[model samples]
Target: MAKQVAENIQTVLRRLQEGDLLPVYLLTGEENYYIDVLSDFFENKVVDEVSRSFDQTVLYGRDVNMDSVVGMAKRYPVLGPRQLVLVKEAQDIRDWEPLMSYLDKPAPTTVLVFCYRHKKMDKRTRLFQQLKKTGEVFDYQRIYESQLPQWITDYVESSGYTILPGCALLLAESLGNNLSLIANELSKIFAVLGEKGAVTASVVERVTGISKEYNVFELQTAIGRRDVVKCNRIVNYFAANPKSNPIQMVLPTLYSYLVRLMIYIQLPDKSDAATALGVNPFFIKEYANAAGNFTLGKLASCIGYLNEADLRSKGIRNAGTVTDGEILKELVFKIIH
Candidate 1:
């Protein structure tokens, strides 16, 4: 069942190239990046270039109704054995019943693809159930923060490059979980570094224009060690570059770090600490150090400080003239002290 859903674009394209085409595909998800990739592949790859001129049809949900889609799907190919009917923005289609009925007896020679972006189809619905029975349904879920480091490593390796230890985590911290943005940044880095070199932390910082010395990851480490001077320097850098290091983003990450530290302290089995905290084993030492530095009571108070700092960053209950830099300085001071 996992293999059937086609998690990666390469799998779907490989199947298509092998002539293992399905009659219908319902590609729906919050992640539009994968949906766009698969939908574009079907548009351009499913048929030969010459045959596509006559056999391919692209329809949008806003511009056409379900009847038009069914009508398109039932048409015979002009120059080949197969035809491609692709519907983009499928979530906008209000009437799915006609499409569901069409899926029940879809044309044998036509390949129907639906690109539903920004949301998923309800699994309990009859339409989704019918799709499962008759065609392919790929659900593209957003990558979680904990999964980003490994994902980055895999993506870099797949692109024929290797990333040094901590490079992936640095990129994940700086870029967050936006896959498309990260991919684009990686493309630039690869283009500059060429194919053979290892992507070190320095390489990532240089190529992506994110700071290696003053990033949130380093700041988190500094706070864990109770190094007030290091924290002050990093926060000062952040204060100088407010656009690069917004208080809103920093506060949440810091808050999350403290919360995870609190959890690490409470767990009975130290062996399972990394798994429970959803962090890599390599970084377990940092959490261990943080747990030692902060008692459970102090950890709770730090979390409260972060909560209040978060509110102030958003201009909620914030007094006049407190800049983001000042708030960050104060927050770091409180945490370090």
Candidate 2:
């Protein structure tokens, strides 16, 4: 009775953008990114701005009772063909049985939309079951970190930007789970790059302006060289920007770097290390200097530290109550010592 598939929120919104009207719409979720957008679409599309003053009514669940909502739904539009009755924060209202009775015989001429933000309707409740059966219900769930890369690619392609898989993943790693911010940033890149232009890693680093000198790249370099001081400095900067540099982004990047170090640690000493690693010649010297400083065990420990750092960022168990800056400081100390 519930729409439970966790996919792009855009799929439901696209249907609404196509302009077909549903008699009842229920949008309930903790993730408001999609809910808010879809609600606005219905409100604007169903009523004219001028006529909305008289015909379209938006009610808060806490302020008014269910009787008031039923009255609004039963009322005819003033000179308009249809009416919009929107209930925001519908999760706050109690005794929804009366509302369910009205919904059983809801007016054909009235469009009712419920914005239940940051919570779910009780599945055991009859009103919830009836609403699910009769109306279009949208559940906005957060996408997982693993799938974010491909999602970013699809999002960019839809906006007319061609991005390589690695580039897409890099942006996804840098931005984390904030789709709205990712979309906003992608729009800026599209405007600057134009069609037929591919988004590259360098371009991403440039536009994102993630501090090229002492950033993840530099941190990796420091870790590879076993320079604890340099690693600490770069990591402190990273901590300072945790909102932008979420642990979701940091863990994967650090993992990838340490894994590469593990591989390099196993290889025999070679004059042409770049050719051995299949990397650009420019990176050969960097890896060459770093190869001797790391061991397989040490690299494994670094990976463990990255995982712990990630958990700390997420506020999981064993996570010390440290600010983002403190977390970075501790990570650097662990890696360095």
Q: Highest TM-score: which candidate?
A: 1
TM-score of every candidate: 0.92, 0.69
For candidate 2, report its TM-score: 0.69
- For model 2, residues 243-305, the per-residue Cα lDDT tens digits are 755556566767776776676667787666544554435555676677677667876887788
Clashing residue pairs found in predicted model 2:
none
Against the reference, the lDDT scores of all candidates come to: 0.85, 0.72
- Report model 1's TM-score to 2 decimal places: 0.92
The clash tally of candidate 2 reads 0
Across 168-212, the per-residue lDDT of candidate 1 in tens digits comes to 888988888788888899999899888577888787788888888
As a whole number from 0 to 100, the lDDT of residue 154 in candidate 1 is 75
Model 2 spans with C-alpha error above 4 angstroms: 1-11, 194-197, 201-208, 211-296, 303-337
Best model number under lDDT: 1
